[model samples]
Target chain A: MNAIEVKDVSVYYGNLCAIRDVNLNVKEKEFLGIIGPNGAGKSTLLKVILGLIKPVSGEVRIFGKDLKETNKILGYIPQTSGFDRNFPINVLDVVLMGRLKNRLSLFHRYAKEDMEIVTDLLDKLGLSDVRDRQIGQLSGGQLQRVLIARALAIEPKIILLDEPTASIDANSRSQIYSLLKELNEEMTIVVVTHDLAAVSAYFDSIACLNKELHYHGDKELDEETVEKIYGCPVELIAHGVPHRVFKVHEEGYDD
Target chain B: MIEAFLQYVFLQRAVYSAVLASIVCGIIGTIIIEKKLVMMSGGIAHTSFGGIGMGFFLKIEPIIGALIFSVLTAIGITTVRRRTNTNSDTLIGIFWAMGMALGILFIAFTPGYPPDISSYLFGDILTVTELDLKIMIALTGLVIFVIVALFNYWKAYLFDEEFSSVIGIKTIFLEYFLFVLIALAIVALIRVVGIILVIALLTIPPAIAKLFTFDLKKMILYAIFLGIVFSFLGLWISYQFNIASGASIILLAGLTYIAAVIIKRS
Candidate 1:
């Protein structure tokens, strides 16, 4: 059964269509990468699925249930830009937020199990030492790991991340990909990213978006689809190897 | 100061006002700084002037007017912000100016001897009445109660609003609830520091506390303690120099923050 099913989804900002009539499906435990250029509605599509942004018209289902009913099953790692990094919250407290599902009592306390889950995730993400440090003090890579730990703390059936490795060192980038690759064995993963090199290496499936669903299927994308999604993108390289992504140019083509 | 507190009801009320103002300001001010809502809070503070003017025109207690105006402005700003494309700071500026304009108009139209509006614009803590004290007590209780009860959710919301909503935390409700709390906190401080200087009291203590701690609860406690100290020190300074109480408090807090910054860097 599909873990996520999005049907006829469209989002608009004013009259500008952000994403249009995009339909996609991800089976359980599948690793899906969404690739698109800037302003291509990649982030918008993720927000729609997370129910953070209401699509102009669409239906999103997780495990055959409505988006609202599937909150506990969805773990999201949003891009870190939208919030104050200097906020006075320690790493442990930030990760512990994932356990906030369905526990809305006044004066609620974190269960003992909640702490264990967060602690374990922190250790796995190599964030144990920075557990008590302020989020503002973390490097980009460390902050990304904290967000990953937070997402995992939900014990989600499906995890979604937006640009998870956007602003980190190359070494940390590979570490994160490997971590996600390990986690993929247990849960479905959907990532929106601009890292084409990592895309082919990590994602079992890929979706190309440009304000609409240009392509959605396996990792082997045709050159025509690539050009259509990026508008001007002509070349693609994967995994530090010179992989042919575009049609070979004619000898007389402009240099 | 101890003997004076026992002798005069007004002195007792002033001390009470100082402590009460510190409590709400410490709590809500930390949120204001953390959430980056300082300008919006200032806009709310300035807009309450219209309500104060309305109270004078209607012959009711001015703080009551200030409360109603601030709550409405908070709702207006939040709603319009969500539905419209107007830049938030621009919207805040509009509300800020409109509130002041309305206050000026209301005060001009009121007949009889012009009331001493300086106390509202620049708070006269020495003149805090029984009614003001009661209102401050109620608001302080509500602010503390709400914050403590929703502490868990608030941390999440402040850290990452979008992720919190995805986790089913009722973020919209939290957003509106927070704005209203800000309004209440502003009104609660109006009698102690007045409108113009209230922002300082609301912001400075928390800003100082932030330098010392990274934990939210510890930061709040430190802010409250700092707030009380600044208020008492300013109160003493004002009494000794025969100067404006509100101005003294704000100046002391401001200078202390600068000193703390310098010391930390050193």
Candidate 2:
């Protein structure tokens, strides 16, 4: 069974259609990248799959189970920009929230095993040094890593990330990409981003979306295909590597 | 001093009730402040005025009426907040005025309204009864117990609502639970501090405690300690000056908050 099955889904906010008639199926352990311009409903699609937003129409199924019924099995890393960086909480405490479901009762103590799991996840994320530091004190990149660590603490079957590297520096962005790539080896990963250039090289498959599904396939997309998806001509500019730039056909202006 | 302490059982009851109420208020106040629901507490306290009026009309226990009205309003506020796109604070303000107006109408209709509306307006700690003491103890115990039991849930609730929901923490349930707890605390406090001054107690102590600590747990403890100290000092000042005890207590807490703000700014 497909790990995530979204069939003919449309989402609307009031009269404005966020996403229209999008259908896609993600197989197990697949690294799927969702790319589009701003307001293209990329995050909306992820939220719909995560069951945070109800689609105006169509159904989403995870592991053959309905989306609404599979919340516990899904780990979501929402856009970091939406979070309050000054929120007063510690790193370990933030991660331990992921284990709340497994606790027997409200009063139940955190088991040694639970602590060990949290500690291990922090170490893996290279955040063990700031385990006791308040979340407010962390830098943007550190905060993003902490959020990822929180998602990992759930031991989810699939992970959904929305703009994980939007505001971080290049070095941190690459590190996050490498970490996500490694995680994809063991879990189904779905990333929603507008950073098409760097992402095309990292993602196994690309789902180009703009309110509707422009393209959905696993093969490496060439410049013409990306330009078609973006409605412009494409240029391969070197930003360390040859990065594809979607150029406007009329003015030859890179977008 | 010994004679003054023993001369009035009512004064003794006031001290006992204030200590218990302060403790409960201190802990719950921290949550309310952190959750950014200080205005909601004010709304709940004002809404309880309708309950107070109802109790006066029926010649029944006003605290029961206060609890019912406050909890129902809490539920209503929570429901409206979830189902609609309207700003919650606006809804709360509208209800606050409506409740106050209803309370006045009810009191006017009642024959021979109690001359001691001041107690409901500004708490008369000296007039606390044995039943009031029992109720305070029970409610305080229950509030503390729930807070301790739901430590992880409360922590998650405070940290991030969306993240907590994504991780399957039952965000709605926890939020409603908090609303109910706050409603209970408001009801219990109505008799000790009166509705007018109750919001002060709920906000000031926690705001003052915030200045001293960054840790949430430590902040709550400090708030509780400060709440108790302010309660006693306010009660003493009220006695000495023959003023309203509840208002005096709130004034003390408010001053402390102001002082803390100044200190932090400097």
Candidate 3:
């Protein structure tokens, strides 16, 4: 059974059509990458899938249940840019938010099982040392990892990420990708990204999105498909994996 | 000094009401400051003036009027801020000025404008009655109960509204619940600190408390403690100097905030 099914979904913000006629399906344990430009509605699609925003038309079903009805099953790691670093909250408290649904009482202490899971997850992410630190004091990479740990706290069946590596250093970026690769083996993962070079090696399948679904398939694409989706021609590069580089065809193009 | 403390029932009532109001302000104020709604609190306080004016004009209880008007204004502000892309601050400012204007005009039109209007303007803490003390205690209990009962939901609500809604916690309901709570707190505090100085009580203690702690829960507790201390000290100073209790309390809170900022910088 498909883990997520988006059937001809359309979303709008006032008069602007953020995304339209979008259709996609994800199988269990598949790693899917969504690639698009700045205004390409990639984040909007992720938000709709996660039930953060309502679609203007069409339906989204997760594991044969409607999107609204299955909120508890879906875990989301939002883009790090949206959060205020100055927010005064501890890492443990933020992670504890994931367990809010299962809490029976206000005074319900964190059980041994809950602590065990949190400790194991933090240890795996190499963030056990900073468990007591305020979320505001962490580096961007550390904060991103903490957000991932929060999402993982739910032990969700599917994890949806939006630009998980946009602001981190190169070494941390690779570490995050490796962590995501490990997570993808356990659950279905959908990531929306603009960093094509960084994420290309990790994604099993690519969904090139604009206002609509330009392409969605498993086989690695040639230069032509990448150029078509990006609105430019692919140039040859020597060192990187057979990647696509768009040439400056327009007058105002930079670099 | 000891004789002065117990000389009058009014003075004793003032002490009780001040302590209760300070605790409520400290806890709820931390949430307000964290949420960056200081101006919203100010707006609520000013709009409550209109309610107080209506009560005086109609010979009804001003607290009831303040509760109704402040809650309605809170709901209006919340809805307008969410639904329309209009500048919420502009709407708040407009209502703030309008409410004050309506209040002054209504009081002037009333048959017998009591000289106690000055007491509501700049709070007469020395004149606090037993009824005022009862209201303050009841409101404090209600605030504590609501915070405890909705502790889990409030954690989500305080973190991120969209994220909380994604987790099925009903963002709209939480927003209304918060506004209602704020309105009730503002109304209860109207008599102790008055409308002009209520925002200071609602924001300063919490802002000062944030400098010392990273934990939200601990920050709230510390803020409450500091609020009570400042309120008592401010009341004593006001009594000794024959100054306005409302202004004195706000000045004390401001001084505490400044001290916290300096210590943090050092």
Candidate 4:
């Protein structure tokens, strides 16, 4: 069964079509990467899948259930650049927020079980040392890890991340990708990012998008598809390493 | 000061108003600052002036009018801010100007001589009646009840609204609810510091508290304590110097905010 199914989704921001007639499907436990240029509605598409933005037309299904009914199983990590670092909250509290229920009760408390899960997640993410420190005190790398821990605290079947490694250092970026690779063993992972190098290296499948999904399925990105998405002549984004380089179409290109 | 309180009911009511206002302002102000809604709050506070004017025109309790106007304005601001691409500050500025204009119009249309609006404009803590005290008590209690009941939810909602919505936390409803709370807090504060200076009380104490603590709960507690101290000091200064109580209180808070910043820096 597919982990996510987006059918005929069209989103508009004040009559400007953001994502138009987008159809996508992700298999369970598949690591998917969504790449697009700036202003390509990449974030908008992610928001639509998360049920944060209402599409003008179409439906999203998660494990054969409607998106609205299946929100509890969806964990999200938003762009860290947009976060308020000065917010008066600690790592423990931020992660514990993932344990919140949507019940209609006046008084709610975090149970002992919730604390245990948060503690274990903090330990797993190597964030136990900064559990009590305010979010503003953490480094860029640590903040990204903390957000990841928060997302994992929900024990989600499908976890989504938006620009999880946009501004962090290369070492931290590599660490995050490898961590996601490890977690992909148990749950479906979807990421929207501009990091083409990392996407080629880690993602099981890649989707190139520009106002609409231009290509989907497999990690092989042809030059024509890249041009269709970016609308410009691009340079060598993929480097030859243990990872597969792009199947070069030009005669003089080296592996 | 002790003898004065014993001799005067007005002085006693003033102190009660101060303490009650402190509790509400401390909690809500922290939220307003954290959410970066200070300008919106100031806009809401100013718009309530229209309600006060409407009250005078219709021969009704001005605070009730202020409450209605403030709440309506909050809903309006929240809806427009969320649904439209209009610049937030531009929307707030319009509301602020329109509210004051409406107030002026309402007062002009009233048949009788203009009422002495100084108390509503600036504030007269000594003018607080028993009914005003009762209103303050009820409002303070309501504020505390709502906050306590939804403490954790509020923490999540304020931190990351989009993520909260993705997690099924009803971010839209929470935003509207928070705006209404801000309106209520502003109304409760009207009789104490008047509309113009209400934002000062709402923002200053919390700003001071933020400098010392990073915990939301501790920030509230410290803001409450700081609010009480500042109100008392301002009250005493107003009494001793024969100045406007509202201005004195704002001045004191502003000075203390500067001092706190300096102290924290070094």
Candidate 5:
């Protein structure tokens, strides 16, 4: 069964088209990486899947159901920049937010069992010691781990991350990627990232997107796809513009 | 001061209500600062002036009018914010001015001479009647009840609206509920600090407490303690010097905030 299916989807930010005619289908537990440059609708595609933004055309389905209907089975880790750094929220409270999906959430308190689950997930993520610490006190890597632990607290079947390691250090990026690689063993993983190297190394299926899907399949990034996505024929443009400008000035001076 | 509480009914009411307002301030203030909604609260407080004027013109208690007007403007701001591209600062500034203008117009049209409306702008905490105390107690209870009932959701919503909503939280409902609660908290503080100083009372204690602790519950506790102390000291100072009660309270809170900054730096 496919974990996520996007059919003929297009999105626009009012008048400007962001993503156009994109199609994707991920088999259950498939590791998918989407790569694109800035302003390339990479994050927009993920937001469409997360139901944060409705596509201007077409549909997104999760676990063969509408995205909203199957939301409880999905987990999300937004970029750490989404949070208020000054909130006095402790790690445990932040993690426990994942349990909000429980049916009998008595007075919005985390049940003892829910706490146990959070503790176990934190331990697995190597964040057990900082469970009581304030979330703001965490390093980039640690905060990302806490966010991942919170996502796991939902016991989701699929997890979506947007630039999970964007602001973190290189060592932390490796740690987070490895952790994600391990989690991919059981759950469907979809990540939107700008790191082309990570896509080449880790993703079973890589989709190169620049307003539209330039390449999609179980293949590493190729030179052509990279050029198509970035649209930077830099050497050709550099040779043309500077040479032409210099020639024009040289002739004018000689005259 | 202790004997004064036992000596006068008005004093007893002021003390009781001040404690309640401080607790509400502590709780709501922490959320406000963390959410970066301090300016929004100021917008709401200033707009409540329209409600006060409406009450006088309508021959009703000014607070009732303030409550209705403030909640509506708050909801209006939230709605316009959600739908339009207008910067929130501009939206809030418009409402802040409109509210004051409306208040002034209504007061000008009120028949015969009226009570000084500056009482709403610069509060007289010593004038808190027994009835005002009862209403404040009820409002405090309401604030506590809502916060306790929605603690986890509030945390999730405040932390990340996107993450919380994707997990099936009703974030829109929570935001509106919070706005209403903020309005009620503002109303409670009106009598204690008046509209002008209510934002200070709602913010300073939490700011001071946040510097000391990162735990939300602990922050609230420290804020409540600080708020109560500031209110008491302000009340004492005002009684001794016969100055404006609200100004004195806010001034004390302001001084403490400076001390906290100095302490942290040193």
Candidate 6:
């Protein structure tokens, strides 16, 4: 069964339309990369899938249930740049927030098992040494990993990330993508980003979106398809990443 | 002053009530600062004045009236903040002025030998009665029970409201529940530190605690201890100089906040 299905969806902000008549089907364990330019409704589409924003039309089903009913099956990692990193919280405390189901009562203690799970995630993510450290004290890469640990703590069947590597350095970006690749083995993963090179190399399937679902399912990003999706003859953004670089012939020409 | 407590029932009541007020301030204050709702809290604190006026007009206990008015205004502000696209500052400002105006109007309309609410306005901690002490303690106990019982929810809600809502936390209701707690805490503090000065006690201790620790639970415990120390120090200072205890206490808290800021900066 498909992990997520979006049918005939559209969204608006006041008078401005964002996504229109968007339809998609994401099979389980698929690493789906959604690529679009800024203001192309990439993030908005992710929000729609996560039930954070309701599409003005159409239906969203996750694992054969309504999105709202199946929301618990999805974990989300929003952009790291969107928060105040100086907030007074330790890594363990932040991750524990994802364990909402285990919170039996106000007076109920976090069980030994819960702590064990947190420690295990911390260790697996190579963050065990800094579990007690303040969030503000961490590097961009470390902070991204902490947010991933929090998202994974819920054991969701699918994880959605919106611009996870937007502000990080090059090393952190590759590490984050590699981590996403590894996590794709355990759960379906959907990422919304503008990094075409990483999308070509790591994502199992690519969805080229620009206000509408231009290409809902494919991994073969030929030069023509890339040019069509971006509405321009794209520049080579490979930056030494293992991607099929675009060969420029004449001006605005694709070989 | 310590000797005075031994002989005067009112002084003893005032001291006990001050402690109770501090407990509520410390506990709820931590959540307030963490949630970044200090300004919203100020609005509610000032809005309680309308209730105080109502109490005087109806010949009822002022604290009881303050509690009702403050909780309603909290709910009202939450509505306006959510449903309307109006700026938050504008909404708060309107309620703040409306509350004070209604309070003054009610006081003016009260029959001859009107209720003496000068202490409630400027805060005279020494005027606390046994009834006020009982009310403050009971309110503090309730606030502790709610906050502790829903500690997990508070953590989740405070950290990220959108994420909390997505995680099946009934975030909207929790938001209202928290606002009501803020309202209750404000009313409990009205006698110890007048409405004008209550926000200081609600915010200063937690702000100081944040300087030392990043953990919410630790911040609360630290703030509670600071609240007690500052209250007593202010009480002692007022006794020595024959000044206003409420103003003295708020003044001490404010000064300590400045000190903490300077120390951290250096």
DockQ of each: 0.74, 0.50, 0.45, 0.72, 0.53, 0.49
Candidate 2, residues B1-266: lDDT per residue as tens digits?
45787998888888888889888888989998888899998998999899888888888887887888899999999999889877998999988998888888778888973546779888888888888888888889989999998887888878778778777667788888889999999888877899998988988887888776767888788888988999899999988999989988988888888888998999
- What is candidate 3's lDDT per residue for A118-157, written digit by digit as tens? 8888898888889889988999899999989888988899
Question: What docking tier does model 3 reach?
Answer: acceptable
TM-score between model 5 and native: 0.93
- For residue A187, give model 3's deviation from the true position in Å: 0.6
- Candidate 1 local lDDT, residue A216: 81
Ordered list by TM-score, greatest first:
4, 1, 6, 5, 3, 2
Candidates sorted by lDDT, descending order?
Answer: 1, 4, 5, 6, 2, 3
Q: Model 2, range A70-89, lDDT digits (tens) per residue? A: 75688878777776555556
For model 1 chain A, the run of ten residues with the poorest summed lDDT:
A246-255
The positional error of residue B21 in candidate 6, measured at the CA in angstroms, is 1.8
| Model 3 Cα lDDT, one tens digit per residue, B140-202 | 898888887777677767876666666677778878888889988987788888888888888
Shift in Å, residue B43, candidate 2: 1.2
Docking class of 6: acceptable
Give the whole-model CA lDDT for all candidates, comma-separated.
0.90, 0.83, 0.81, 0.89, 0.86, 0.85
Q: Clashing residue pairs in candidate 1, if any?
A: none
Tens digit of per-residue lDDT, candidate 6, span A1-255: 999999999999878999999999999999998987789999899888888888899988999899656646888898887666767789998888777762236675677887888889999999999999999999988998998898888888999998888878989899989999999999999999877677767888989898888886667666666667678755443334344633332343333
Residues A134-237 of candidate 5: C-alpha lDDT, one tens digit per residue: 88788999999999999999999999998998999989988998999999999999999876556656778888789998887864444445556778742332
lDDT value for candidate 6?
0.85
Residue range A74-113, candidate 1, lDDT tens digits: 8999887868887889999999999996546899899999
TM-score between model 3 and native: 0.93
Preferred candidate (lDDT higher): 2 or 4:
4
Q: Chain A TM-score for each candidate, in the given order?
A: 0.93, 0.89, 0.88, 0.94, 0.88, 0.90
Best by lDDT: 1
Better of 3 and 4 by TM-score: 4
DockQ order of candidates, top first: 1, 4, 5, 2, 6, 3
